[model samples]
Target: MAVIIKHNELEYAAKESAISEFALLTGKKQSGAEKHMKYDIRMLEAGRFSFPYHFHRNSEELFVILSGCAVLRTPTEFFEVHEGDVIFFEMGPDGAHQLYNHTAEPCRYLDLRTVSGLDVCEYPDSGKINILPEQEVYQTGDQVDYYQGEAQVRDKWPESVLEKSR
Candidate 1:
């Protein structure tokens, strides 16, 4: 079966932040979509940005410009994208991106991504990583070595326990 939804039918909700004012189409809820991927439509007002510069560790994402124009910032470059443009972002630091609507009118784009049980997102500018599903945010520099807290074990099993098994 196929799911069909018109853009006009999408319910938009305001998402306010320090750097942007936008509306988001909650596709998962609207379509009752689950499993492989998730979709969202982000509508950004002129001079507003979509989100912070960040990259995912577990999933890739694709963006398609639905209307108007915007400036897209990747780790190494900035691109002026217009309607019908499609962009793919791989999972990594190299894929970090931010989209800003610099045109005088609003811009809309589809944000699609793979669904993952766990996702780690890195925010380079903030020196933080967001662990999803658990929704924990931690400073990148605060990592502890893997075995840092393990207690030293001198023997594989205690003598009394081993004797009882024998």
Candidate 2:
């Protein structure tokens, strides 16, 4: 079976935060695409921003400008992208990017991502790391050694088990 979603039938859901706000219409999931990729159409309101300046450790992304213009900020430069423009972001620090709808009108684009099993997204400006699916965000500077919390593990064993082992 094939799923065909008409442009006129797109249902947009609003998402808002302090710095970013956009209306998103999810497409890949509705099309029964499960593993390799995911995609959504986003309408970014004027004066609003997209996700923060971040990049993925395991996944790559692409953005296709659908209707309006926006300023794209990458690690080394900032430039304008208009309708019909396509942008590709690789995995890692070099791919760090953010977008802002600077025009008076709204800007719409297609956000496509490669769905690798898990992804770790790093925010350079905020020094934070986000784990996808789990949706957990943590400070990058708060990392600890692998065995940092493993001390006194033997104390957790039962007395009967200890005696049996002895």
Candidate 3:
């Protein structure tokens, strides 16, 4: 089936935080796309940010500047993007990025990203980890070893169950 949603019909949802703010319209969902890729249209107001500076372990993203301009901050450098510009971000640490609208005018862009069953996003500046879909966010500094709490596993089982296994 083909789904066609006119740009003029897009209804955006607004969100704001201390440093971030945007009006977003989920293109993928509106089109009934269930897998593989996700896209959204976003409008970022001047002096606002798109998202936290982070990189995905399993997903790649692309941004198309539809109108106006913004400053893109990455791990190594910053870029001034304008209308008609397309930016691709690869997966992992090298792809860490965040966009800020530095201009006085509002900026609109299309954010397209590959979808995965599970994704881990690392925020280097804030020492935080975010698990997508699940919406689980944790501080990296509080991480524990895999086996840190697995001691005395045999004691957890009843003596009768252990004897049968032996």
Judging by TM-score against the true structure, name the best candidate.
3
Q: Tens-digit lDDT track for model 3 on 34-127? A: 5798878888878877778899999999999988999999999998999999999999999999988898997888888999789999999899
lDDT of 2 by residue, 53-147 (tens): 89999999999999999999999999999999999999999999998888899788889899878899999999999999698999999988999
Would you give me the overall lDDT of model 1?
0.82
Note the Cα lDDT for every prediction shown.
0.82, 0.84, 0.84
lDDT, candidate 1, 42-154, per-residue tens: 78778777777899999899999999999999988998999999999999988899888888998888898997789998989999999986879999899889878565643
Query: Which pairs clash inside model 3?
Result: none
Q: What clash count does candidate 2 reach?
A: 0
Model 2 local distance difference test score: 0.84
Give the lowest summed-lDDT range of ten residues in model 1.
20-29
Can you rank all candidates by lDDT, best first? Answer: 2, 3, 1
Q: Order of candidates by TM-score, top first?
A: 3, 2, 1
Clashing pairs in 2: none
What's the lDDT of the predicted structure labeled candidate 3? 0.84
User: Lowest-scoring 10 consecutive residues by lDDT in candidate 3?
Assistant: 19-28
Candidate 2: residue 159 lDDT (0-100): 84
